[model samples]
Target: MNKAINAELLDLSNCAKEPIRTPGSIQPHGFLLALSDELTVLQASANLGDWAGCSAAAVVGGPLAGVIGEDGVQRIVAQLGPELGSHPFYAGTVGIRSKRHFDVLAHRWDRVTYLEFEPVDRAEAADFRHLYPLIGDFLLKVNEAGSIQMLAQQACEHVRAVTGYGRVVAYQFDPDGHGHVMAESLEAGYHAYMGQHFPATDIPAQARELYLLQHIRLIQNADYHPAALVPALNPLTQQPNDLSFAALRSVSPVHLQYMRNMETLASMSVSLIVKGKLWGLISCHNRDPKPVGFEKRTACEQLGQILALCIESREDARELQFRLEVRRIMVAMLAGLTQGSNFIDNLSSVFPDLLRFARAAGAAIVVDDRILLHGDTPGKEEIAALVDWLARSEHGDLYHTDNLSRAWPPAAAMVRNASGLLALPISRIHKHYLLWFRPEYVHTIEWAGNPREKEAADKALHGAPLQLSPRTSFASWRETIHGSSVRWHAGELELALEFRTALLGIVLERAEQMAELAGELGRANKELEAFSYSVSHDLRAPLRHIVGFSDLLLESAGSEDAVQRQRFLKNIKESARLAGKLVDDLLSFSQMGRAALRPTEVDMNDLVNSCIHKLAPETRGRDIEWDVAPLPVVWADPTFLHLALSNLLANAVKFTGQREMARIRISADDHAQETVFHVDDNGAGFNMDYVHKLFGVFQRLHRMEDFQGTGIGLANVRRIVERHGGRVWADSVLGESASFSFALPKHEDEDEADDGAQADNPTKQ
Candidate 1:
């Protein structure tokens, strides 16, 4: 018996010394590489040396799997083979070298009939993201033929770019193990295996079937030498055949021999299919004897899945092509007629193409109250009788037609002039008004066939043979068009539904944004209110104290009691000082909130050094133990940020004075969103329940005697934190120790860019 070897014969005019490049022409990833399954490199990428090392060019046509360092290549192949269990490549990191990593993925993705490649670096957080309605956009564009082929090409280019391999071909397969080249976006003048055919012996029936089921298969290398197969003892037959070769140590020789004949040492193919049939394949060919490992192989598999789903959705398939061509014109006609153009004109334009009338003149009635799509064919008397009958009937229908002249209404006799008539009731769920036309002629012309089939008036409206049988006539089949076709073309209702959802989203988003802006404006207004409160309270406090003292002195003037008056005057002076302090602190706190967040990379050690120097003069007078730890560099607003730290530090110094040797500790820590600084002191603290009250203006936790505070210091700290998109809080124990902490938002590294933000403005989010 002859082998079912499907192959392509070579045909060339002259030795095609790679063609010259046209500037701006689409370039291949590398030098052109083609090989038969024989495992000899036919061509290669221009810069294979980057991955294949210095001796790459010489390694062309060599056994690809044998050329790789055994450890990496062998393990990749093990994972490729069934013996390793179908563990996906993304399961974990397999630290393979760069070349093997790239090759392994390309090989496997194509092997299992999948497209494979590395990501376009998702690690970069600053990468640009598409601003349009991404989900909808992707869904629509992906189904276009040009779009799918472009996607395939992009996957190939990515592999070549990453692995430094040359050309990646978009290969497709037929059921008989024959590969047909579908699309190829190559790197250079180098012609690839595009349009070429590959034989079935290279990929067995079982393997091809597996490719359809799995959607991907990876072959890291072909020349993989496996461990010797272990002989098995059959439990029943006791023959070698009884043993399971499923876990065999080697790939079939027929498979290996096929690859050798093809001259392709290392290759991968991605199988694209739909409804259990082979559709297309994206095959990558590498010139040098290269080996791809497990991790890279996984990347390829993922890429293949992505490409396969894309191809399946593309309009390139025969059925899809037919559907797409028809869908556009019909949907447009529906839309233009139903929604955009004047409904009457659009309906009239659709009439000539869809239906015809030889001897008919009839009015279309839209029962203003009933809401129906009324046509004139059904006699006016018949329609009125039907309507009256419908009004009288409760089953949502009324159906008797032939002897309409005998019916109560004079218009009922008009039915005699009509050879055919139909009547259907439209309701809430089935919304369009009933259509009554000569079903024998109308159904054949407009209903049963595709609009694409329309040609002339004499023929069926769809150019198909007309059938006037009662079974296919209007009188009989009013249910079909009214019940199905007209209902399917329900453009207005569906559009209204989608519009409702999209409108809601837009409205909600706008409302949310407005609320945010309003809040910011409100905060600004509050700052002015706080300023007014401070001005009034501070001046009144001082004036009240002075007035009280003056009254006491005046009273003493008669009694000659100078000592009481003197004490009252001193109280007035102290109160005046406290009032002045309150006004100053209030202004400072308000300023913190109003300030803009100026982000920069701040060296914490240097910032702390400056803060310590400013506080050094005060520290010299007390026996305070100041412990400062090493600080990390952070990104933050400088002035307001420092104000927060200053307030926290001052609180520490003021509260930690009870002991003979006061201890104040300053330190910083890192977090996902911000850098937090803490000022810990052995001071009198407050109860846990009062923590919420601590950050509010004028909400003091302790009296001046226990722990001195204007009640605005912590509020100032909170204002500073929020300005930088961060928050601050504290924890403490009464009379034991207190730790005051504040956080400043960490600055992102300038080198990192947000890809999502196409416009550089941070305020846009």
Candidate 2:
């Protein structure tokens, strides 16, 4: 930095020794310029054929502001101040009066403010030379990279060296248009208003626009006006479409009064644009209106032209490097998917450049709605809750640097000296939010003349200085934002919109890849269903053949043998029957997968009655009491529903087969969302522990030799009920009582029909 300072001073000194190359150019007889903090005399040339009344040595190092009247300091700081910072300055001709006029050229070398004044008789002010090209190389350099840091130093050095002011400092403009001293290359023991802020509206729109265009400009004497210029007939016209160097001929009296209040005069600047956007400024200040005569003004013009390019080139290089790095990180995120890698699990691979670009303290990612902190020891569940809250907020915009640690509902966790928080909604589900935690100092530029130093000083002055915590602690924002306002960047919203589009596309592409993986899972499920169907049909075919052949052989050999032969045939016949039963069970198992419900409204009482009627012959002559109760209507396939109910009814009857006073009951209960029907019997019951095994095909609570079952009856009932979007459950205890109940969704269509008349309801089954 010191090297840069020396170079800036050396360059200014070299230009001072440079002899005027253009003979026809206007030169000052003797012009004074304010530098660092003092005043000095710049070169005087022969073009002063009329203004030679003064010599260069007389005005040089003179108290410039002191030389003018009381209004000198205020007028100079207010009018010619902006030329120092952002855009280079220049001066143009405007007739002051019908008979009075002067030739003017002005430029700001940062803090060293210079204005060359050549007063002439109205008939002739043309003696001033064209001096815009002297600093062409420097202007081009600033335009390419736009580094205000270097420009500020040069402007200050020039002001300090040429004008010899007490202090020359480059005041920078915030996005809100308020100015702050960004740099100060002044003499020792000279510091005043280095970090002070100047109003945006004070300069107004017309003056601010002028700084973006020209390489040189001036306000020869801000307080020199005799009368305000006439207003133009029309407003700003598109005819002169370009407005880089906009100027207002008339002055507003209200604003003039405001300037008087501030006691500032003389301003000039240079424009520093970053990423095709105007970033900030380079402004120079003066305390007095030392006549920066025509010769010095011409020199200031050459200086403005050269410094513009130098500042631009230096700033552009830094931005180029940043953009390249961000692009690389974006590429890595894209590559993660193709490699079959867990992109969310490894945030570093996806954004290897995140910490590089931002001095983050920690990082995390939210993938598939799961939040994970990336590091040796990840954050607790509180971080996940914080992430969820942010994702659901109405402000979907990313939070560049938010302190969530001390925030409500998440006050337990805090990160100190946190640089910034990035709330990126990078996915459609918004599951991907890249959190970049950085140190606070990384974002804040260290300043030697920071205005806040006074706030700190006030505490020290009282000897009650506040002790600030270490950098890694979360601090309150109330202090930093107190009574100050800024618009971080102009057109910032448009830039965010641009990044959103690009990032949204990236997130969508990742979503598509996830969908593809899900498609593969769906295919696997379909394959398993197909395989089960094929095995059921193929295996049942051979069982059917085996049962048929065995039965035939037994019938043919029946008469060939006596008792032994008959017993052997009996065994063979039993084996064939068992084989047939197994085939039937396998067929039932396969049918469950293929069955589709044909839901219709039906009276549960009638369905159960019909099923009972079908089983009457099997229960003939048995002393069994039948307790048939009324049943409500339910939605189910009539045939399948009958099969389901009949199986339960038959089991009730069969279990009571050995009982002397056997009883059977058919009943149901109506529940609003559904109707439940049951066939319960006081018969030989089984333990409840085996109940879960009751509804699986070929899985029976009892052996076939003892209970005589294909082992698929209950499973079939379950399948039928499930097809109707209903369910079945059983309750039984050894030798006490047993009940088989099933539920079916009661469609609203059955409500109009009475339970007794529901047998005819079209949707009932």
lDDT by residue (tens digit), candidate 1, 340-427: 3233344445443222221122323334233223234554445555555545544333232323333435533353343333333322
Deviation (Å) of 532 in candidate 1 = 8.6
Candidate 1: lDDT of 69? 48
lDDT of candidate 1 vs native? 0.45
Candidates' lDDT values, in order? 0.45, 0.48
Q: Candidate 2: where are CA atoms >4 Å away?
A: 1-101, 104-118, 121-148, 156-168, 175-282, 293-306, 329-338, 341-343, 346-354, 357-359, 375-378, 394-399, 402-419, 430-432, 442-765
Task: Estimate TM-scores for all models.
Answer: 0.29, 0.40
Worst window of 10 by summed lDDT in candidate 1: 468-477
RMSD of 2: 30.0
